[model samples]
Target: MQLKTKSRLKFTIASLLIVIFAYILSNGLIIGDYQIKSLGSITKLGLDLKGGVYIEEEIKGENISKDTIDRTKELIELRVNALGVNESVVTVTQQNRIRIEIPGVYDAENALKQIGKTGKLTFRGPNNDIVITGEDIKDASVGVNQQTNQPVVQLKLNESGTKKFAEATAKYQGKVISIYMDEELVSAPVVKSVITTGEAIIEGSKDIEEAKRLAGIIKSGALPVELVPATVKTIGPSLGADAIPTSKKAAVIGITLVMLFMAIYYRIPGIIADLALAVYIMLTMLIFTTALKATLTLPGIAGLLLSVGMAVDANVLIFERIKEELKLGKSLRSAVDAGFNRALPSILDSNITTIIAGLVLMWLGAGQVKGFALTLVTGVVCSLFTAVTVTKFLLKNFVNSNWIENKKMYGA
Candidate 1:
């Protein structure tokens, strides 16, 4: 009797703690100035969810090489990052075009002005002769001047650039070598000495942020091929705002019905399954908000809902197996063990196959398809753990506690 009491106490405490943690994760906690954001707020929403602008730009010249297109895409991504847009995606698309998706950005014209510029960097002499181009730049980084403690951009040049720069410095030691980006004057630094080691520095940035921005632009290099904006469109946030609440309602209603059905039909085991399901939901959201940093989309929500159903289905299978074992005159503990053991193969086969399919979709698909695959795979994996491990552990503890040993409660 004492052992049973201890077991029940431990199980009750554990279950309560799990519930509290899940609640905290879903709704967050706040104490004074300290606050934890809920999973929904922490997880990033995709362009479809947050509503931003997408621009498709086509290469102007015909028969553009793959290398050129890839380079352009990379540069565009860097420029987008420089614009302080987080979670922007730059993808090479069909017909020698590249697509850029900037989420949470509403100013389409400003975004275009920042990312679509040619950014052709050049150093010109007194007579306006080109001394070096962006292609000659090997690297550019923001650094501080050790002597003055001021922000500056350090440049590393290629071999040809080094030779040309050395000549330019020698020819105009006390004269200004003006730097230009797409014909707009950026800087004019006087050549103090001939630099033969291929390294240079640009000073006079107003602050560290300005220095970093200039460095980022220079580091991205110029686009290899000219590009023209093929299409530009903006998605309004109102649409996403509407979809989010609807998705939440659907998930809540569906999960509630599943939980009610499980508790009604399966009794004790169903309640435990619902607890495990809660853990699964918390775990999935934790992954999306932290490890994966996944962007939630409408399709991703569908995947999440589908995986929730799968989790319940797994629990149902195990409960039915337990009922069969109970009918065979097995003891309660033996029936529980045998049920999980027997259901293991089927559970593994289904989850494994689904995971494989999700991986394939993630690999081959793009945009919303990829988002769906990511959430589906993550949710399915979490479900497998909760079903095979968490649910089994909880059920075993309840059985050992002997608090509710009635065969009817076990659905026998």
Candidate 2:
């Protein structure tokens, strides 16, 4: 039984090492068109680390409700989207304020102009006559046309507003039904037919971009209240670009020191813990890039570093328990088992509380806080996996192989 368990444990370690190496090589070395694009792609960045324009729009008006703040947020989000800045952030701040962060964008002025307007969604007749106001519309979505390779914004009318839309479409079929945001003719769809139903398609054009912008505007819906720009601030990406190299250096130093400490303190079990930690790190990166689609910010890198400490702490706790058991004259094999079993409850209780804190941050925090919370949560989850399962599995195999029988090496 002992020999069988020992062989199985070694095989398991070897298999895990092979799988980890294969995963890394397959993702990094395979270079197709798609792979090449991915290679050039810097990981998605958050507002602080990537650095772009930061604009604050103060809400004005008497008796401004929570709903009004929410509406302003939605409208600002739409305008930010119209600016063609990808991965923008729009958040509602305290004291009736809205904050906008546009990441990795160069033309701050253009982006500012795009979002600085009083958002108005309008529908116009063929002769540029006003048909209906944005308040009449209920919902809008960007959709792909099955028949034609084009995008369209499908608008839904309010129940009471259906008659107005039907009448407008009846007179405007085969003519341009223009949708506007302030003076901009966002969508000019040629009406196909006149129907009483509330649905209408704002057709895409030779420029698919216009369709996308219109879609964002319509999808944002009408703001319940108007907003005036209170403040606008722009930060250059150059600053973020400078900080990234520093973050990378910190990550390297942090990981290297942790690995060295583990090996020096715990000997064989410490070595196993280090190996598991490596696996933990690799898996965390893979999940961040491929699963959660997280943007790695400087704070996010800091969260990763913190998690490395937590992972090491978990191992230290378990190893210390083993040492205590050995001091009580327990056998090497029994000491290892009792150590894990005894330390587990405390380990679980501590990390579970931290995980709860992470969940709260994810709920209430936006932008960088969200990124930091997400990375920390992922790290906690992966640490539990590595410390509890991976380390235990490795130690079980090592002990069964009769590799280290001395209680001194176990740090008794």
Best by TM-score: 1
Q: Which window of ten consecutive residues has the lowest lDDT sum in model 1?
A: 212-221
The CA-based lDDT of model 1 is what? Answer: 0.86
Clashing pairs in 1: none
- What tens-digit string does per-residue lDDT give for candidate 2 at 1-412? 5685765678477648846664654355454654422311536777677878877777678898774565566566767777666678788876677888888776767876677655677789977888877778787766777898687777888976688889988898788878787665666778889958888776755555556556556655555566677877777777677888888788789889988988888887888888888778867777887787767777788888899899888899999999999999999889999999999998999889989999899898876787789999999999998899888887777777775677787688
**For residues 1-412, could you state the per-residue lDDT of candidate 1 as single tens digits?**
5867877887898799898998888789999999988886677787887999989888898777775676577667766877777778788766677888898998899988987776778899999999999889999888999999999999999999999999999998889999876665667888888888999898889999778766765665677677788899999888889999999999999999999999999999999999999999999889977998777888999999998998887888899999999999999999999999999898889899999999999888877788889889999999999999999988998998998989889999
User: What C-alpha lDDT, on a 0 to 100 scale, does residue 216 get in candidate 2?
Assistant: 54
User: What TM-score against the true fold does each predicted structure earn?
Assistant: 0.76, 0.72
Q: All candidates' lDDT scores?
A: 0.86, 0.77
